[model samples]
Target: MAEARETLEEPILTGNGGPTDLAAMEPDLLDVEPDQTVASGRRRRSFQFGWWLACGWLILVVGAALLAPILPLWEPGTPDYTNVAGGLSASHPLGGDAIGRDNLSRLIYGARASLLVGLSAVVLGAVIGGLLGIIAGYVGGKVERVLLTLTDATLAFPGLVLLIAAVAVFGASMTVIIVGLAVLSIPTFIRLARATTLVIVQREFVTAARAYGARPMRVMLREVVPNVVLPVAAYGFIMVGVFIVAEGSLSFLGLGIPPPTPSWGSMIAAGRTELLTHPQISLIPAAVMFVTVLSINYVGERTRKRFEVKDSNL
Candidate 1:
C-alpha cells in the first residue's frame, strides 16, 4: 500500500498537474541574505571615505591658490626688515626668515612655483611617453624590444641625480627645472602605458574591431586608449606629488628656481642658518611641503583602490 501511494504522488508532481507559477516555485530566490546586505553597506562606506579624502585635498590646493591675491601677505620682492623682537607675533604668524621677510607671505607665493613645475612636468611626460608606449605595445616584435630597452635605460638613473646634473649644466631657472623633472619622469609613464596597452590589445573587442577592417588609428584611439586612461590618470596624480617634492628639494639645494622669487625650497634653505634660534622660518615651509605631499599620496592611493575595485567588478 505504501509503494503504490508513493508512485501515484510522483506522477502527479512530475506531470502538468505540478505548480505552474515560477514565483511560487522559488520564493527564496528573491530574498537577500543578511551577510550580503552588510557587505554592500561596507563597500558604500569605503567609497564615501575615499571620495571625501580626494575632495579635501583638491579644496586645499584650490583655496591656497585663490587666496593668494586677497591675503595680506608680503609681495614676493618686498623686505620685512622687522626686528627679531617681533618674532611669532600676530603680524607675522609664521615668524620672519633670516632676511627679515615674512615667512607666511613667502609660503603663499611658493605654492605658485611648486604647482607650476608639477603640472607642466606631468603633462610633458604623459604626452611623450604615452604615445611611444601605445605604439610599442600594439606593434610588438622588434619595435617593442627597442622601445622597452630605451625606457629601461632611462629608468636606470636616479631621478634626483639626473635633475641635479641637468640643472647644474643648464643653470637654475623655472623652465630648466621643469624640463629636468619631466625628462626624469618620462620612463615611468612609458612603462605604465605600455603594460596597460598590452593587456587591452588582446581583448575580444579589439580582435572583433580588427576583424571588421577597422583602421589602426581608429582601433587605438577608440578601443585601446579609452580602456587604459584610468590607470594612467591614477599614476599621473602620484607623479604630481613626486614632482612637487622634487622641485622643492631642487630649490632648497640651490639647484632649482633662482632666489628672490620666494620658492618654498629656497625659503627653507635661507632659514636653515637660523634654525636653532628662529626655527619657525624653516619649520613652517618644511611642514607645508610635508603635508602637501602626504595629502597627494593619500589621494592617489585611494584613487588606485577605487580603480582596482571597478576592474574586478567588470
Candidate 2:
C-alpha cells in the first residue's frame, strides 16, 4: 500500500520528456526557489562592481600616462648603481629594476608608448576602413567587389607573420609599428562596418532619406554612419586592448620602440633574466600590463553588451 502511494505521487513525464504540464502536476516546481533568486541578484551586483572597477582602472591609467611628465617622479632612465635590484622603499615605491632604474617611473613612461600605438592605430584603422566599408556597402556593385576582394586577400595572410615582416622591412620605430598595426586592423573594421552598413542601408529611414533626394555622400554621413558607428566604435574599444598587447609583444620581440626609451614590454624583457632573483622587476610591469588590458577589455565588453541591448530594443 505504501509503495503504491509513493508511485502515484510521482509526476507523469510527457512524450517530449519533461514533466507533463508542470504547473498543473506540481505547481511548486514552477516557482523559483528563494536561494536561486538571491544568488542571481548577487551575481548581477558583483558584475556591476566589476564593471565600475574596470572603468576606474582605465581612467586611472590614462590619467597617469597623460600627466606623467608633470608628475614629480624620477626620470625613467636615471639609474642608481648602489640600489641595483632593490625592493620597494620610500625612493622606489615599486622598487628598482635590474639596472637600478626606477621601476615605477619606467612603468608610467612605458604607458605612453603602449597607449600611443594602441590609440593611434585603432583610430587610423577605423577611419580608413569605415569609409571604404561604407562606400562599398552603400554603393554595392564593382566597388564592393574590388574592396572586399582586397580585404579578403589581406585577411587570408597570416597576421602575425605579416606584422613581423612589415616591421622588419620598414624598421621598428613607433611610427612603423603604428602604421603596421593600423593596416592589420583595417581588414577587421572593413568587414565589421560593411556588414553594419549593409544592415543600415535597408532600413526605412535610409530609404526615406534617399527618397527625399539626399545626396549619396550626405546619406552615408548623416544616416548610415550614425547607425553604423556605434557598433564599430564598440568593437574598436575592444581592439584598443588588442593593439596594446600587439605593441607590447612587438616590444618584447625587439621589434618595438628601442631600449632606453622605456616600454612595458622592454622592461619585462630587461628584467626577464633576473626573474628568479628579482621577480618584481619583470612582474611589476607585467602586472600593470595585465591590469590595463583586462580593464580595457572588460569595459569594452560591457559597452558592447549595452549597445547590443539597445539594438535589440530598437
Candidate 3:
C-alpha cells in the first residue's frame, strides 16, 4: 500500500507503461510527512547557516572595496614617503609596501579587480561551455566528436603558461585575462555537463517527454537544463576561487594588470624585495587569499553534497 502511494505521488510510472497524465496530478508531486517536514526544515536551517558563514568573506571584501575611498585610509597608489619601514600602527594597520603605499588600501583595491576577473571568467566559461555540452550530449555522434576534440586540444596545453602566453599576445588587459582563463576553464565545464546530461537524457522522464512528441529543443531545455544546472552552479564557486588565486599569481609575475592597478599578486611581488626587512606587506594579502579560497571550497563542497539527488525513475 505504501509503495502504491509512493508511485502515485511520483507519477513517473503507470500500469499501462505509458507516460502518466501529469496535468491531472497535483504539482506538489510528493506529500510531506510531518516528521519529514521537520527534518527538512532542520536541514534548511543548517544550510542557511553554512551559507551565512561563506558569505562572511564575500561581504567583507565587497564592503572593503565599496568603503575604501571613503575611509580615512591613504590612497593605494599614492606613496607615503615617511612610512616605508613603519610596522602596523593606527595610520597603516597592514604596514607599507616597498613603494610605501598603504597595505590595507591596496589589498582592498586588489580584491575588487581579482574577484571581478574570477567571477567574470566563471560565468563566461559556464555559459558557453554548458551550452555546447548540452548540445553535444543531446545530439551526440558527429557534433560531439568535433566539439570535444577542440576542448581536448585546449586542455592539453600547460594552463598557466598558456594563460601567460595568451596574455602576452593580447596585451594583458582585464578583458584579455578573462578570455585566457575562460578558455582554459571551458573544458572542465564541458566534461562535467556532458557527463551529467548523458545520464539524464536516458532517464524514463526524458523518454516519456519524447514519446509525447515534444520537440527536442523543448525537452532539452525544460527537462535537461533544470536538472543539470544545480551541479554546474555548485562547481562554479570552486572555479571562482581558483581563478582568484590565478589572477593574483599572474599579477605577482608582473604579467598581470599593469602597475598602479593594485592586485594581491603584484602587492606580494613588491613586498618580496623587502621580505627580510618587513614581511607584513605580502603576508596580509596571502592570508586574505587563503581564507577566502578555503571558505569558498568548503561552502562549494557542502552545496554539491546537498544537491546530490539520485535520479528518480519511480
Candidate 4:
C-alpha cells in the first residue's frame, strides 16, 4: 500500500509536457478551467493564436448560416435580368448571379446546404459505423469478418464515381445527396472505430469488466465506447469539411441539387460562364468555401492532437 501510494504521488511525465507545447496544442485549456501552476502559466503565455483565428472565422460563418433565414436577407433565386453578371454594387454587395439573384443571399443560404449535408452525413455514418465497429472489435469471430468485409467493399470504389452513381440512380435531391455521402463515409468511421476499439479492448479496465461477468453489451457500451469516441468525434469534425467539399463538387458537376438552389458549387458553375466578365460572382462563393473548409481542418487537427496526448497519458 505504501508503494502504491508513493507511485500515485509521483509526477506523471509525458514526452511533450512542457507548458509551451501544451498551450500551443490546447489553448482552450485556459478557457475551460483555471490552473495556477507555474507550468500552466507558461502554457497560457504560449497559447495557440492560430487556432483562435481559425475558430473565430468558423464561428462567424456558422453564425451567419444559422441566422440567415431569420434575418431580412435578400432573396437568392429571384432573378434580376438587368443585374445579371453585375459587379459589386451598393444594392448587391457581392453582385448578381447568372439570372440576377443576390450574391450575398445565395452564399448565406448556400451555407445551409453545405453545412447541413456535411453534419447530417457525418452523424448518420458515425452512428452506424461506430456501433458496428465496436461490436466487431469487442466480439471478434464471424462478426468481425462480416463487418470488415462490408467496410472494405464500400471502400473499394472510387469515391467520386460512387457519389455520382448514387446521385444518378437516386436522383439529385438533398436527401439522396446526404444518404450517398453518409454511405461513402461509413467505411472510414468503421475502420477508425475498429482500430481504436481494438486498442482499448486490451486495456485492463476492459479486462476487469469481462472478468466481473459484466454483460457484453454493457461492457462494450459503458467501457469501450466512451473511451474510443473522442478520437472518432475529432475525426468527424474534419470529415464534415470533406463532405461539404464533396457535396459542392456534385453540385458543380450538375449531379447535386438543381439550379436556383444557391449551392456553392452551383454558384461557381453559374459564374464560370461569365468568369472573364465578372469574376467576383464565382470568386466570392469559392472564397467562402475555402475559408470554411480551412477552419474545420484547423479545429480538427488541434482536437486530434489534444486527444492523442490524453490517450498517451492514460
lDDT scores of the candidates, listed in order: 0.78, 0.86, 0.83, 0.83
Off by over 4 Å in 2: 1-47
- Per-model TM values vs. the true structure: 0.83, 0.85, 0.84, 0.86
Instruction: Kindly give the stretch of ten consecutive residues in candidate 1 with the minimal lDDT sum.
Output: 29-38
Candidate 3: residue 250 lDDT (0-100) = 91
- Per-residue accuracy of model 3 over 123-217 as CA lDDT, tens digit each: 99999888888888999999999989998998898999998888878888889888888989999899888988999998889999999999999
RMSD of each: 8.3, 10.4, 4.8, 7.6
In terms of TM-score, which candidate is strongest?
4
What TM-score would you give candidate 3 relative to the actual structure? 0.84
| TM-score (C-alpha) between model 4 and the true structure | 0.86
Per-residue error for 208 in candidate 2, Å, reads 1.3
In terms of lDDT, which candidate is strongest?
A: 2
Higher-scoring candidate on lDDT, 1 or 2: 2
How many clashes would you count in candidate 2? 0
Q: Give the winner by TM-score: 2 or 4.
A: 4
lDDT of 1 at 150: 88
3 against 4, candidate with superior TM-score: 4
Off by over 4 Å in 4: 1-47
